[model samples]
Target: MPKDPANNICQTHIFEGIYNKYSKGLHDFLYYKYGVQTNPKDKTQEAFIKLWDNCKNVTLAKAKSFLFTVANNMVLNEIKHQKVVLNYQKKPQRTYTNETPEFLLEETQFLEKYKIALANLSEEQRVAFLLNKVEGKKHSDIAEQLGVTNKVVEYRIYTAFSKLKAELENFNIK
Candidate 1:
């Protein structure tokens, strides 16, 4: 280990620490956002390599953001280069003889309001809330993935629920 601050520049130990702390999160983020089409693992590694090549200039506070930005840009560039047409089909409506038309209409309206409420959340709040609720991630897992503390994750989820609850107060949640 280099004891001198000046000598620690791009040191092996420093690089390893950065890689260890961020690799899994970066990989998971890329995979979640781009799916298999972006070759997320490869793109994640490319981001790390880019970071390593510029290690001297990257501070610890900015490293994570830098990695994500590079990965996002790479995926965006690849997307622009390829013309893709998705074959999308809407799902058939549910039919239940036991339920009244009014009930079905209410349910559909509730779902629409819920989606609108979710969409209105700030990006960070939405990400935290979705990772915890939709993805079934524990607070610790979300914190690790977000490079934040568990308390921050808790706060985010709590606030998200508060906002959603307030937004949907007119609906019957039962």
Candidate 2:
């Protein structure tokens, strides 16, 4: 049965009338504003779908304005998304080195052994060594912080280095 055009557009006949009336105009507006690359025809269908979904709330009188507004906003969002994609494509991509798997395995093994060797050191030796080497502090500065003599700080760091070198000697660190 045919629905009255002045009544609610929730009726199929009235909704079809709205689609037939506005679909072409909305498509043309989107195409002229955003170009063919943005797919104006698809956006036109989507706007109609939105209108149909919200048919209960939208009056027949306001249907044309609703479709145009939805279609225009959809095209604008697509254009903004395309701009972001283009900007991402314009940025330089990072290049990776082609290190051998065997070399990487050896490096990983060396690091594990190094951590174990560091853990094996006496607390005094580990603290002094890390403060001197990792923290880049002088022997006198380490001695002042640890409340020890400069010579004692020097001895601990030397012992820690000797132990680490002996323990990590078997693994090839690349």
Each model's TM-score?
A: 0.43, 0.53
lDDT of 1: 0.83
What does each candidate score in C-alpha RMSD? 17.5, 14.0
Question: How many angstroms is residue 71 displaced in model 2 relative to the true structure, after the best TM-score fit?
Answer: 0.4
Best by TM-score: 2
Which 10-residue span in candidate 2 carries the lowest summed lDDT?
Answer: 165-174
- Candidate 1 runs further than 4 Å off: 1-9, 84-174
lDDT of 1 by residue, 19-74 (tens): 89888998899888889888998998999899888877777668889999999999
Candidate 2 stretches with Cα past 4 Å from truth are: 1-6, 97-174
Return the number of clashes found in candidate 2: 0
Displacement of residue 22 (Cα, Å) in model 2 is 1.0
